[model samples]
Target: MRQGRRTGTTALLVGPAAAFFLLLLVLPLAVVVIYSFGERGAAGGYSPAFTFDNYLSLATRGQAFLNTLLLAPLGTLLCALVAFPLAYFLAVKTSPRWRTMLLVLIIVPFWASQLLRIYAWLLILGNRGIPSLLDLLGMDGVRLINTRFAVLLGMVYGYLPLMVFPIYVSLEKLDKRLLEASADLGAGAWGTFRQVTLPMSIAGVATGSLLVFILLMGEFIIPALLGGGKVFFIGNALVDLFLQSRNWPFGAAIAVSMVAIMLATIALYMRFMLGRSGLRQQALV
Candidate 1:
């Protein structure tokens, strides 16, 4: 009787949370999945009939898919390049007195809306901004805004902090005595870092890379604002289908495809990461 009461109490505690999770996350995903396999009504939105027409419509957005596929990884790579060095400097090099201030500076931008920050980038990179400044110095016709470069730049800037904090935490937790021991064994700075530091911080690198990659794949706003609609992503295509074209079935199909692709990509990425870690361990041994 007592054990039965305990089981009931545990269920009572977990029931609401499970219900909320299903309602918020599972329900929406289920709805999208169901909508994807259905037909769009003549008046827009989902119709009762099941069909493959919506999935077939993806070919129409080929260019958008290609662009998103190519650039999202590029953006993620760029973010890692910028973030890792900055994170290392902050975590490994900076004095405690200055580190706090620098970290705060890095994080201060989050208090503002992302929309507002993207708009700010618009002014800073536009024709009258960086271009005009360059022209004054005899470097004329420097177009920065609305280009692929601008889109990549905005993505890097927007997500750099997210990329940094994880790596920073990893680096911060590193055992400095390990470095000292390596140096005593005549290992050069580069050797010590390559064998010890890099291996140790691989987790952070993978975390940041995955975070940036997955988010970039679904990015629409950066492309819309910085690409100026010229360099459209699949996300932008989905937006148009659902909102502008009112093709709910097609939009749901696109959404489901994106989710499936992301899941597959992340799984492969993890497998590669795990294999790499095992190889590094073998090499060290």
Candidate 2:
């Protein structure tokens, strides 16, 4: 009787959360999946008939998919490269007094809306901005805005904070004695950092990379504003499909595909990270 009561209490605690998950996440996803296999109406919105045409027609948006696949990883990598040194400086180099102030500086940009930040980039990269300055230096017709480079620049700028904080936390949690031990054992600065510091802080790097990659994969706003509708991504394609074209079935199909791709990508990434982590553990042992 007591065990039965305990079971009931546990169920009572879990029930609301389970219901919320089912009602919100699971229900909407189910609806989208069902709609993905359906047909579009004559005017707009979804129709009841089931068909494979929507998924089959996904090839039409191949360019957008290609662009997303290419840029997202590239941007993530760039963000990681830029963030690592900054994160290292914060976590290792700076005194505790200065570190807090510098971190605040990094975070201050996020207090403003992302749209406003990108708009600022837009002005800086526009014709009469950087290009005009370049023209004075005899590099006339230099264009920075509305290109793949502009999109990449915005991506790195916007996502830098996301990349930094995770890495900083990871490095902060590192045991300092390990470095001291390495030095006492006659390991030089480079060797100490390579074997001790890097391995200890890799979790941060992995976390930051994954966070940046996932966000970049679904990024629409930066590309839209910076690319000027020229450098398209899957997010842009979905926006156009659902909102502008009102092709719900097709949009749902693309959304489903994007989710699948992201899942597979993340799984592979995790596996790789785990394998590397295992190797690092064995090496340390």
Once superposed on the true structure, which residue ranges of model 2 sit more than 4 Å away at CA? 1-5, 183-189, 276-285
Q: What is the C-alpha lDDT of each candidate?
A: 0.87, 0.90
- Candidate 2 per-residue C-alpha lDDT over 58-121 given as tens digits, one digit per residue, 9 for 90 to 100: 9999988988999999999999999989998998889999999999999999999999999999
List the lowest-lDDT window of 10 residues for candidate 1. 276-285
| Ten-residue stretch with the least lDDT total in model 2 | 276-285
Model 2 scores a C-alpha lDDT of: 0.90
TM-score of each: 0.91, 0.91
C-alpha lDDT of candidate 1 relative to the true structure: 0.87
lDDT of 1 by residue, 41-77 (tens): 8988888768898788789887888888888889988
TM-score of model 1 (CA atoms)? 0.91
